[model samples]
Target chain A: MRVYHFSEQPYHGAWEADAPSLRVTLPNKHCDPKVAADLINWRLDEWQLCDELGLNIACNEHHSSATCLSASVNMPIAMMAGRTQRARIMASGYAIAQRPDPIRLAEEIAYIDVATRGRLDVGFVKGAPYEISPTNANPVKITERFWDANDLILKALTHQDGPFSWESEWYHFRQVNIWPRPYQQPRPSVFVTGGSPGTAKSSGANGHGFINILSGWNARTLFDMHRLASLEAGHGVTPWSKFVYTALMGVGETREEGHRRLMDIAGYFRTTSKVGEAFMNPPGYMDVAGNVRWLKANQTRGRAGNHFQAAKRDGEKLAIGSGVGTGLGVSAQDMADAAIAFCGTPDDVYEQMTEFISHAGGVGNFVIMAQGGEMPHHEACANLELFSKEVLPRLEEFDQSQIHADTEERVLSQRDEG
Target chain B: MQTATMTVDHVGIDVVRAGSGRPLVFLHSVGGVDRDGAFLQGLADRGSLTAPWHPGFGHSELPGEYRSVGDLALFYLDFLEQEGFEEVVLVGVSFGAWLAAEIAVRDAHRLAKLVMISPVGIKVGDRETRDIEDVFAMSQDELTEAAYAEPERRKRDYSTMSDEDLTALARSRESYAFFGWQPYMHNPTLRRWLHRIKQPVLVIGGTDDGLLRSGYLEGFVESLPNARLSRIANAGHYPEVEQPQAVLDLIDSFLEEE
Candidate 1:
């Protein structure tokens, strides 16, 4: 497994339980520029440490929020490209739907890929529902827009023959010719992250990597959908490398200490749920069926009133049950039981990971949120150091190729018999 | 009252019709419409009421190609032509009013008069401020409060509703978002074309409308060549629902004017 160290780069100092929200509604006056600068510099230093420690690096973007400082994902990737040498850098990812200019994004990614010397894995995401209003993007037809943008960006990156004219429902370009073409021949390895089967199917059909982040039991189902879609598209069974899983991770000298550290890191979830109900589920963000399900659930829970009451009710859920897939668990045991987090001594953490991998069929990339919430810089560095030294070698030794080959054989035999 | 599926341009449109006289087309707001509602009866009393649920609102089949208020307005124009209506009186509420304005702007020759109730289609505020409250952004209860002078009077118990009712509710929400999400509720360039509508217009607004500011109703009157403004007390966005008699009185007087 190729384990990638990731952090949301959260500004934990701004987290206040009484605050209306930590996201879109939170005013900029709460954000201290000097402290933000220090935090950004510290996080950068930690990413540099990952390079020396033999761990791959991953970056993600969020906007108009104190939860994540990385509003523009490209800036960090470009910054890391010049600093890190061997580690494969990934953005999981840029919000394609909200971005108005795909051609400009194409140029920026191309420059980053060239700078990284072809060591880049590009990831495109649909962004958070709460960000719809903040980005001033239409929530309707967002998925359609995302696909078009994705196609346009790829075309821009690969078409080196000459300028091309492109026009679609959501975007229009008179001429598309991006300079500094990607260093990778065909294009850089692409990854897409989402929680829905439709998204997984699209990712697979497009022959792109799929990342399932803390989706719990549903992660395997989403991966299988991706595999089936790829096969149906006549692309052959997708390899283990095409599937990635993300979770909060922590390690320490003892099992109890590791659990404690991970619990601390999981504080990220506590702050994340502070979003107001008004922005929780914007219309058209979720599909019709999904909205119906959510509405029914809320009504059943007697939380289907005004915004404040609904937000409070959801906050209660976040403290307990809703944390199953997300890292909002009240206890270390809750997180570990859900398999959305791995924490303990090297041996314990390794065993938990292998168990999860077995349950998931196979996952080649493990995206680890090493630093989250109020984790001090020194603590984050120590966690990374221990994980790299003790667990990385064992994880590298575990081969997915044999497992995948066996599964393929079993499937073929079953098909023949049927 | 009768609900029939009328095919226009190969698309199914659910039209509710009642009474008979000079054709009065009733366009509903984002909340869809109640075919059996008392307000619709008041409209029937006024003239031959022909209320068709906008495509994608209720049982109407939403054409994939139709994306904006302009498209819906054009479809409505076709509906009027297909039905062979003359001296048409166009009456619309809320989002439907926006459609009516667009229709009048396009072609006012067939329309004798226009009535817009609690309309939201034009931007009257500065760049940073929005003229209409974002229905998608607010909570259901918040929206209820904004849409009704007495919020409790408009409360709906979805749990008690039938499966079809619930599905219709969800579909209406989805359709509303699809049409109004971008550029919000107003067409930025629409204000420029208001002069094209020469038909006498009566713009009705709720005095207590939380969705619209005071000046928004006045702005519509000022833009139209032959138009006037009236307000209904004890009502919010849907004046006809809260104070039907008052709104109907104003409509009756306007229609009777020589």
Candidate 2:
């Protein structure tokens, strides 16, 4: 398996106990920049360590929220690309919908790929509902803007050594030209991440590398559907290497320590997350059924609600329909039940990850977000060390060689039948 | 009243046409078809009235090309010209008023007179001017509560609505976001072009609307050439629906002022 290290880069500093939320209401003065500056440097150093330890590193951009300090992933990713030598720097990635200029973004990504000497993977996400106010985006056009920018950016990137022009419902440019093309020929691999069937169909039909954040029957079903769509494109099928399975992971020297690490992730969630439905997801971001569920969750919210639904907040409600990340309130037990998170000794974590991979129908890229919430920098670093030493080696047995052979055999048999 | 399908630019729209005097075109607000209440029938009593659901709102097919309020304005102008309606007495309400103003500024030769009701266009102030509310962010109940003098009078409960009504409302909200999402509600540069509308105009609105403040009505009236203001008592955005007789009287008086 192609192992990668991922982190949302939480601030991990103290704030008001009952601040309502980590986003809009939380005062900016509460952010200790001196502490944050050190934290940012420390986080980068951790990524550098991961690179030295022989692993890929993935970082994401989030805005207007204290849950993640990565307001802009490009600058940090570019800086990290300059610092690291071996590890592939992937951004799970920039919110294309929030960006007004796709061409500027294209040039930035192209330059980063060059800086990395061809070790860049560009991934795009639709974004959280809270990203609306910061981006000055109309929540109604979020999906439209995302796809519009996606189409324009791809065409700009892979324009056959081009100076291309783009005109669409969202944007109109007279000329599209970039000074430096991508380091990787024909551009680096492009992937779009989403958890819904609609997103799955789109990513599959477009032949994009589909990375699922969840692993289970839903993931297996998504993979199968994607494979079928790719095949229907006459582009064969999505290669096993193109599928990424990302999960929250925590590991320690002892079982109790691992459990504490897991709960720390949950504790970080309970204190920081606000359970407001409209703030998390405004209207038009979801479908009719999604709105229904959003309403249902909003109705059931408060002290007397189910511990599972109330603790995790409405952030996880997005995950219920689409396969994005889990809500912070997700306990170690909840994570284990869904097989979306692992926290234990090396062997126990290894077994859990292997089982997750099996349920995913075998994926090539496996990203573990071991650092999140209030997990101390040293603690996060230690968890990574345990994971690298114990879990990383055992993952060698879960590669796609067998799946590739099986796929080849199936294609040949189908050809014979035809 | 008669209702039927009208095709414009290869897209089908449910159209309501009534009365048989002079042709007076009525462009509706973003509230969509259900806003076709007693006031509309009153307007039809005086003249030939033609009202179509805005494309993608209330049973109207969503054509991909109908992306902006500007597009809608251009389409209505084209419809009037194609149908050979001369000296059109045009009436626009809320979102539709913005469309009417767009058409008038671009080309006003065909319009004899124009009336705008609580229009949402022309940015008057950057900081002091209150913004149009984020209607798409609101629930159906919230929308109804803010839109009418008495929310219960409209009976716009989501639970009571038919599947068709609910779907149409959802689509209308989508259309609202598509047209007015970025600029919020008012057009940034439209204030400068208000002088281009040469037709005699009447700017009318309700006194008490949660969505619209007094500044919007004042700003709109002050910017226009050959314009006058008429306010309805104890009404919100849909003054015509809330106080139909008062609004009807104002329209009748405007028409008589030849």
**DockQ, each predicted model:** 0.51, 0.30
Worst 10 residues of 1 chain A by lDDT: A304-313
How much does candidate 1 score in TM-score? 0.94
Q: Model 2 scores what on Cα lDDT?
A: 0.73
* Cα deviation of B190, candidate 2, in Å: 2.0
Runs in model 1 deviating more than 4 A are A297-329, A410-418
The chain B TM-scores of all candidates, as shown, are 0.98, 0.92
**Candidate 2 off by > 4 Å:** A12-21, A24-27, A138-148, A158-162, A168-170, A267-284, A287-330, A403-418, B127-130, B136-155
TM-score list, all predictions: 0.94, 0.88
Q: What is residue A171's positional error in candidate 1, in angstroms? A: 1.1
Candidate 1 lDDT, tens digit per residue, A321-363? 2221243435775566666688889898898888778777788
How large is the i-RMS for each model, in angstroms? 3.1, 5.0
